[model samples]
Target: MNGRSPRWTVGGPDLDLADPHFYTDPRHHGIWRAARDAHPVAWTESARTGGFWSVTTHAEGSAVLRNPQVFVSGLGMRLGADPRGVEAAAGRMLVVSDGAAHRRLRSAHQSWFNGRAVAALLPVLRRQVDARLGELLARGGPFDAVAELAEWMPTWVLFEMMDIPGPDRDELAGIMARAFDDADESAAGAAGRTAAHTEIFAYFAGLLDDRRDCPGRDIVSSLATAEAHGRPFTDDEVLLNCDGLMNGGLETTPHAVSGALLALARRPDAWRLLKQDPGLLDTAVEEVLRWTSPALHAMRTAAEDTTLGGARIRRGDRVVVWLPSCNHDERVFPDPDAFEIGRRPNPHLGFGGGPHYCVGSTLARAEVRCLLEALLRHVKSIEVTGDAPRRPSNFLRGLQRLEVELVPEAGNGRGAGADGEEDVHVHEAHEHVRATGDAAGDAA
Candidate 1:
């Protein structure tokens, strides 16, 4: 306990962390700074929904996340999630389940994200990223990096891994965008979210059925054939988990990539530093994840009475761990606001901790690292031509659109991975990603 009383009262709009606008507005950074300084663990009251304990500091947020038995995720993991919907998916979904159920479910899909498994996908990932960078540079004008590059890379990798049919990929991607859309916490917004989920489930349900009779070498097939408690996963379990995996895979890395470009654009010196010393790609990617902290907050319900930061928490009280705040905690990372590429021992909770740590973290790191490598090998500089619009969602924080001019490296006719320099960095970066298993953040 910090011995300081929790900020029990919500005094103004700035303190209303539940509002999506708070995330989009630049002032939110200062707001989190103030909140963390005044009340590391504050009691927030929302009239529209309900009240929750906002865990803002790194120490307390990590403590809550690390102790899942006391703070269970089965009730809900996000602020605006519908209570009834959460109840229905409680034990079935991987993100919401706790205890033994969560372990078994995670084990079923763990093989896909292991270091060797993700390492196998590096060549394909590198090629795709390189090709995309080449195409964008050839156009020779300002382009929407979000629509063209940031969103494209992860979506492609996810679809390829899932083996979704070519024609169906576009439709599924659109539905997924809506499923995690930055909608408000209102009745209408809830309906829209539910509809998107229904569509995703229906699509995955068909895929699950197809995988049952003729299993393929993909995640869906593995889940369809996987056995837990000596029994196969039921249709509901498979469908719900598929929804969780897709949401996690698609929603996070794009924002990290977008945020990376935005961060570099704002600080050209960082980009120049990376170009000069490509070996820094490993730490640079970690810095991007820490700086972005795309998965803004994760919620958990108290399973038993507990005292957190000197505040009495009832069994049913909801506690939300603000990831960005934790990542930005001055106590943990010195000069936390500065995007220092060479930061060492960065213990950012961009990814939720404990049993619910992000399963796709390795793949996410690979994707970001590949993009940066492509940029270093081909693009000379990143210039932000227009205002980068941010996604308006309290749960997810990222740029919705980034208009940037990608200047091609001089005398480099070919796209990414064209020259020998790429090979050297790729080898080094690949070894780094495979070796550093502790890297964490975003999407759990």
Candidate 2:
């Protein structure tokens, strides 16, 4: 409402989202390569949200997060949106909060995701992943792995962790998806989000009360009765944490699960290799997280003036640490674009860095590993029927829908991933800029 219009920018200043070249065209790799090289920290003026400094390098990204005081997360992660959306989402408890409150809130849930803590929840994780795989097999042939693995898989896992009980798990999953879509810039989007938040919050509020009276072996119970600052968590805090867990855990894992399937589908050799040595699952999981690079960017506004990548960032200026882009930075990764299962010393920024690295990173690793083991154990091969569609957001990155042929492990090698596509293993596809100002568009 304030600006002239959503001023579109690109290597070609005339471009906008409506350009079919971006939508129909798949290889925007050139654009990303350009942004990284020509201007590691590129800026584009606003038609709407003014401008944002995109940090496409690894070292700069690390700096953005290492000093939270300088690159604050609470200013709102998705570059610029309505102030009302940010305020409406106040009390939300994920990585967005800063300082003492953030440190304290993070500690409260520390036990829930600690190595020992997550390992304890493994048995349940195994059962759920296995059951889901069987359902995938019986359902047969063509199936939306995104629906099964990405969406339902993590939902069930998080549900069990939160002690969500029976059918409400599905409700919570729907609500969480709605929460992301609720970020849409429309009254309807806001209304849907409000209702979804109210329902899930109310549901958790009641459970928190019940847990307070009769504690159980669930995370909600842990938080409801938790007392760190000489008091119980405020009602809003409790609900935000629950919703945050559901949203963060749910969207992230599914992206990896489904993205891995897509990645492996593209490389049958990798899929076949996985079949022969399931021991490689652990490495495979890390590589999957790196290759897919879900949860695209995390925001941090400068708390004070600082220098990053030779740019003077003044206090209050907004800077975004691009996660997936860093994963593909040629300087850090020999071949940043290619998905290498054997990527040694593969310290990708997929989970982020510094004190703000995904608190649930370990849990996410275990959850994804569990799902992979189950899928690899039963399913022999996977094939995609058409081009995979990515979600439309600059923040969260994952598939919207992925059609997959769940060929049985016994699949007589029929209909395998095409010729050159036979999953060869020569790693390293690094990125470079084309010396023009092209943007990879916001992939959330």
Candidate 3:
């Protein structure tokens, strides 16, 4: 059950996990398998930003992620991150903070993402999935699902939840997209990223100020009015966390959705299983999250000297956990490469682990489940039409473009319920899904 295919040969010295190009190559998966087998906690030398240790196994990754005290996030959470920028974001941003500060910051946003809160959002999410998918199906032509369908629902939901003005959404989303662009690391790319961050900071600053005087139910207003560690969050703290929330909310779901669709197109059998048994939506959603592992890796710095997976460590050492690799670990998941919708005891860390586990996880699962539900009710079949280009980044494994034709169901008449209300099926399977506790992790 190691899932080690015959094609995966051991990578030689030229293998560099830090390179973005390394991920896009088809050989990357095999390389990871080879690395995991050879050295689960091997030290990787990166020409771009010195070197770091790569933790590839599920057990080791969970250990590092859960023990944030030892593998602190204050230094940086990704490769090649500027030290100055990481220092600035350390305590203010939830993703990079540690201990009490992390807990307090996470608390401010917890209520909004709790099960009850996510349940309230189900209607809105269903409507969004229906409207957008309805339009695409009506068009009756091949389309890039990434642009047309995958990206819209999550973007719309995040903006709506934040109460961001309709007019400003497109511009803000563009900026946010650019802010996290790891595809190109050239000088121009760096400049574009910096510019995007600047715009995002400014946008949130204005929103925070407005909410300070006149608060509302939106996240901004909550953060604006809330206090942490005996004092109200300063403008910088609110602004930083706002940036983090925006990134977290918008980044993970779309990639997961698109990846799910691509997986379905490739494995029609899985789609058929869902269509036959609508109750399988919960487990299918879990399978999607496990398969995608969108946030490729998350980094932490050693707070003090430590030993992990028999590797020697020192304080301030950088440790990167490859999430997708961990998800594919043979020890954790039997038949790791196979896409099994009915996978039980699936403890994949697609959402990450420990203190920084995704606050938006409940909402994330609901979003994916609703989309899949909509597809099952409406789409008859999915076929890949053209090239599906993956986003080139060392951090995110997302589709830049996914060209596919969605075949509509017969006699469904736009897939609306007979009563014309949202035709979502509520099943006991959700309890199991919730129990699995799989989540979409932080944007870092």
Candidate 4:
């Protein structure tokens, strides 16, 4: 809440939004609450990432997102910025592009990510959810939900959508996960990051070549053949946009589901209610998105001298909008901290908003809803078996490990550890498939 510019307030209690420590601990909430109450648009100076404004309140954060013209993304939408410069080839990606370019790129893939598109994929997603959950339930107790189920859900779905082969899919997933999770700035870290990017870009470049020769029904091929703003997308634009979709598809919804599982385990009453009435999943999914707010914050550069939440913002200043704070804004939701499954009119900024809103919103909702429906229908109870380790990432609030003991419902149970007859055949089949995949991936 200091009145002094960030330059003068360097050694003060400057909020470093890019720090992974705040995300893994409880201190982030208190800091954001103070920002919301006293300095919704506070200045923060970090030696690593330089100075930026912290936009914490719901109204002001939403305002910054909606008014993309005033708060631009072209300078790079990430903290520490994009070290390679914003105008680099990959800068044309959907997350950092603005104005006409943004619209054009988004429009190219809009049809594949709309509500109808997701609805069409409902059967496929449900089967995937059931298969994964069933395998986890059969394994008995104390399972890491992230490694066993949450992480696999979106990777399978996204791979299917993009027409990536099974062997390559797992490798690419590992590469992308490492690239995003590695926020280190050391020389070795930089080299590793560059190698990952090189591998990914080279991989996609091959896909682009294939698509150019023979376009298919998949997303990448569609993008290759599609036009944006009266001309076909350049190779660089295609590569960046494809990479952007992969990152977006992989990260957000899975973490939200893991959070929801933790929430349900803590509140048995909410779990019981959802179990009784499965139709409440739509509202329940919205509440989970709000409660988790996985994509923690997004950066925007001020396009002109402006004011936000009563604080003056100068042109060229970096503004980080804290989505978690906005979702928990007291002014918007009553009992904002409580995990209310039936929360209505939850206008959360979890998937962001306005022109740059996540195009994967529809798919994310469908994926989360499928998981909830599967959990409600199959499991009788979910108890926390051990400590749930949170992933250390400033931008992503994910669970690294969530050990849960799941009790299956009557008649549907089929395992020695559970209260039913053992299904050795199904368990062995799942293991075989898993082993095969692991071997193939290792060989690659």
Candidate 5:
């Protein structure tokens, strides 16, 4: 065993926690292997929060999520150098509250994401997917998929479904992005992060009050008028719920859409296979979840001291679970690094596992299915034209600018193909709705 960490180290797990090597570089290999083999549960200090434990194996990690009585989500910096500070700043937000409290908080809006509600959203999602693909074509040729297509696509759909005031939609989205970055960048030990989150909550509070007095048909209206715990939600619940929806759906769905497009750019044959056989769509989505493993990691704090994979963790210590590492674990998956459509028992933690599984996973899936299904209909090939700028923060693994050509096969469809093309335009709207910065903060 490697003895205690040096006093000078940035963070534990014996790696450069500050630079984000885990996500952007191959250096993640040994660090993860070490964590998997011996140090499944470990502790480390961060500049912002002092220190926390790092959880890397599937069984042990799943244990933490399943037993919320023992661990709470949203303690913050699940995989960074700043646990003490982030945890200190945690508001016991929905993502952090455990057990009964989590139940009470989540109950405020869980029904809105139930299967019935999600199934009702399919038509709208498909239409939006169809329209957006057409819009990309109409706008014609070469386009930045990440910005023009990937970044705004799902957020726009979410805005419409949430019945967010279309006028204030863009600004609200920016606020959500700022809040997300705040949590992500806390490793830099910035005090402004808390203030930003507060600002986001205040704006959401005002928005919730407006929805109550002038309820409309959107999600805001639903939360305002709907009964929860025998009456309309309390003010805190209402505001936090909207904030949750915004934070939950904002960058996630978009990343899923774009991450797949990214995998395709590098693996043309996969796209070719999908275009020839659309039945692979379902498998393709799973493949994307496995290969990209969005959401990076989820953090949980020990309710009491525990041993994981033989590693002893102290009570109240923070443990970070690496979703991408688990997804790529050779122990659970064969060729874990390769993307394949027919991967069975995929069992990915992409949306997380156990009770806290992403509430909008079904919605996110349908949205991606429609988007990819539509993307294939429009573009024939996709290729990266230049060095893509990765997102600003380390937690999200995506490109800020994915320059590509959309070459439309003349007889195939009246649109552009995936590789690289410029000049075309098409647009449409969705009928239903539902559900990032930095490179160094990605996954291991």
Candidate 6:
């Protein structure tokens, strides 16, 4: 309120929520903090995406997410110029759909993605973690954690759940890494985006054809044979929904894991506490989720005129809720900036809330827990080798590369990754950016 202090007035130069640069830069927090104190719900205009409301506080954002009837998700969860074809096509996916259609599609695989299912897969997931760690340890030096370790769990688990063949895992993961990138500001990024989507659709379509008659217990089989409203899913429905799962499965977990590792490397006290008391892993996981809040924001369209945080939201207006800001909301989180490992009652919006809450949250949490457990068991200390490169996207707070050197625990024997072979196979870092700067927005 002070005229002397710098104000981030909405619709001015300080308010460009859709810009990728806003996310990449660190100064946005001061602006958001100011927004929370002054304008809880602020309006802004973008030349690229037109005009929309920016909801900065936790209470208003949560209310928006909860009251889906008012703040809808059907128009595609991004704030930019309307890509009619893409929005129309993406609407069939659960994240972009609303009401009965969203519920129906979500219910098809709801049981499989629940807490119980994730708990049951713990042993298998542990083995997967151990195997990946073994490979990482085989190489006797520093490695990019984003490429070598953090990125391993999600896609592998997704392929396993979907019963994708071992041979196809790497290729499919590559396609997925390419498909969701909307941060590339280059001309080639645009062409690659289309090509990547085409390949992904064709791959899933072929899998659907193969599994149509001889349906197995895989997710593809379940979807291939699922019937909603007494009718089977059309081919387009199946493909897009499959792609939706792939998109969800591909991005969030890695971001969390990499971010968690970065947090650990920085905060030695929390890292030591976890090492000394592994029982604190769950609490540590929650703190990590809160700190990372990887998926930055979710865009909702107003279905009806409503008043929120003392501002009138007109029907059909876009409401972009910043999750990172909500996670750092001072009202809910005391000392919101510190990375305290054992913070309790930490109900962070990292996974979001309401009907459109992340369906794969259970799996994501399990993966992070497993990753932390593996780190605590195997590594004594981890140090950052270089600056972490972030993916150039506004939506996903993802790391492109994270270089870390692991110090193995004393008395722990080395695994196959200890082999000092001249040539070792490691998954290199991937850079995916969409040319148009849409950032591949999601409901989560």
> lDDT for each of the candidates?
0.83, 0.69, 0.81, 0.77, 0.64, 0.78
State the weakest 10-residue window (summed lDDT) of model 3. Answer: 1-10
Displacement of residue 151 (Cα, Å) in model 4 is 1.1
Separate clash counts for every candidate: 4, 14, 0, 0, 50, 7
Against the true structure, whose lDDT is highest?
Answer: 1
**Model 1 alpha-carbon miss at residue 158, Å:** 0.9
**Candidate 3 residues 1-444, lDDT tens each?**
222222112476676677887787767888788778888887776678777888899999999999988998877888877788889988788888888888778767776677765676676567668777777887788999998888887887777667788799989988998999888879999989988999999998888878888886677877788776677888898899889888888888889999999999999999998899988888988999999998999999999988898887778778899999999999999998999888888998988888878788878888899999899878999999998888888988889999999999886536443233422322222232233322422332
TM-score of each: 0.91, 0.84, 0.91, 0.89, 0.83, 0.89
> Tens digits of per-residue lDDT for model 4 on 1-444?
445342222224554566766577766777677667776777877666777887788999999999988998888887864557466842478888888877777777776776555665666567667766777777777888877778888887777767787679779988987777745667787678678777888999999999899976667887888876799988988888777888898878789888989999999999989988887888999999999999988899999998887678888888999899999999998889899888988999998877878888877888888888888767899999999877877788878789888899886654222222223332333333323321211100
Q: Write the per-residue lDDT of candidate 6 for residues 219-317, one digit (tens) a residue.
A: 787778888667788788889888888888888889999999999998888899998899898899999999999988899989998888878778887
lDDT of 5 by residue, 163-236 (tens): 66668877777766666663345444355555556777787777777888887656677667766456556676
Whole-model alpha-carbon lDDT for candidate 5:
0.64
Model 4, residue 222: C-alpha shift (Å): 0.2
Return the TM-score for candidate 1, rounded to 2 decimals.
Answer: 0.91
Stretches off by above 4 angstroms in model 1 are: 1-5, 8-15, 184-186, 416-444
Better of 1 and 5 by TM-score: 1
lDDT for model 2, please: 0.69
- lDDT of model 1, residue 216: 68
TM-score of 2: 0.84
Residue 304 lDDT, candidate 2, scale 0-100: 88
Which segments of model 4 are wrong by more than 4 Å?
1-15, 89-91, 183-185, 414-444
Model 2 ranges with Cα > 4 A deviation: 1-10, 14-25, 80-92, 182-185, 411-444
RMSD of each: 5.0, 10.9, 6.1, 7.7, 7.1, 7.7
Q: Lowest summed-lDDT stretch of 10 residues in model 5? A: 435-444
| Between candidates 3 and 5, the lDDT winner | 3
